[model samples]
Target: MYADLWSFALSTYARPGCEAACLRLQAQGADVCLLLCGAWLEQRAVTVTAERIQALKHIARPWQTDVIEPLRRVRTQWRAMAQQDEDLAGLRERVKALELDAERQLLGRLEALAQTWPIGNAIDQLHWLEGLAAEDAANLDHDALQQLRVVVTNA
Candidate 1:
């Protein structure tokens, strides 16, 4: 049931209509949570308090592992390679290739992560992925500068 709820939320979030679509999806997700919570409370024969509801929301927010470690390692390796290369012409192409490949991997990983996040704010999750992408891009820019310097000296 949770899986179905999450899938619906994600699809609804992705659909392009207007502001109304987003509102509708959020309402549906929250309603499902309420229904599940109600059933759980009824089954347990316990009164649901505000704190209990908050706890349910917390559980629903599902945590996703930050995917920065692999990206960090890739960036560090690229930085080292850029610093060590003497010929810019030969290494420039390779450097560009590395950045391109890293970007591709980053997007794929981020999208995969989004799919796993709980059914609250997939939009916020997407924004967080964008943050990781932006930060990674900056690291690439710095690495490229180091690479260019090595190239200029050898040329």
Candidate 2:
């Protein structure tokens, strides 16, 4: 288990298939911060509840929408042109870093919010994932979710 949320998120996201699962869930309007947090809690065998899911969502949505998404939008908007333009490419790289920083900040806030929550004696694994993505859960890839579960659990 990670000592901090940022480390956990970084390691988990880097795991094979986790990125695809995140992106797929993102397309369905799920917040990656929440997903990462969910995974962190799952790893620690935290008991997930509807109230907890909402709390995480409430804490993450504002920063993700206001800070992270704009940086991501601009970086993505310049993707094609950045490949051809040296200056834009450099700026785009900076934006990418900024986006990552913004996400780290969000994770820090999340860590602060629930750092005191007790770990469960029995892990209700994937309950957070299902709650966070309940509206679009059916649309996501089962295999990718399974891969994430395997990686997270084994971590």
Candidate 3:
């Protein structure tokens, strides 16, 4: 659930010309998926005691590196873009078109980078695509494009 929602929010928030909007949302305290995931882990611990809490924290520490750090990286990029003076309209338009042509697949390039994902976790595999440059993902192969179909339902 964190993976899916985070993946969806990541791409939407990173729209080329929407940096200001993304920052606004973040400032309002959204995109705190890590916090929610952490809470979930804590609650699911064997007991609601100090030992269980410590154990949950230990289990979740490594995940913070893999999952939380990616989201933080995305937030960093969004802040940088939000502060830039560059005009991103044209680039955004180009990305939309390319994404459309590729059948609205947003995760294509990232999937290619990872080569493949575990069985039954296809949608979550898109988690690797957060904060990426759309231009960098512009060139995708067939399998990558197929994986991207996970982003846009109608695609």
Candidate 3 Cα deviation (angstroms), residue 72: 1.8
**What local lDDT does model 1 show for residue 93?**
55
- Tens digits of per-residue lDDT, candidate 2, 17-52, equal 789888876776778887788778887777787788
Task: For each of the candidates, give the backbone clash count.
Answer: 0, 0, 0
What would the TM-score be for candidate 3 when compared with the true structure? 0.26
The CA lDDT at 133 in model 2 is: 58
Q: Is candidate 2 or candidate 3 better by lDDT?
A: 2
Global CA lDDT computed for model 2: 0.81
Segments of candidate 3 deviating more than 4 angstroms: 1-47, 82-155
Candidate 1 vs candidate 2, lDDT winner: 2
C-alpha positional error of residue 153 in candidate 3 after TM-score superposition, expressed in Å: 34
The alpha-carbon deviation from the true structure for residue 69 of candidate 3, after best TM-score superposition, in angstroms, is 1.3
Worst 10 residues of 1 by lDDT: 126-135
Model 1 residue 8 CA deviation (Å) reads: 21
Candidate 3 residue 49 C-alpha distance from true site, Å: 1.4
TM-score of each: 0.24, 0.91, 0.26
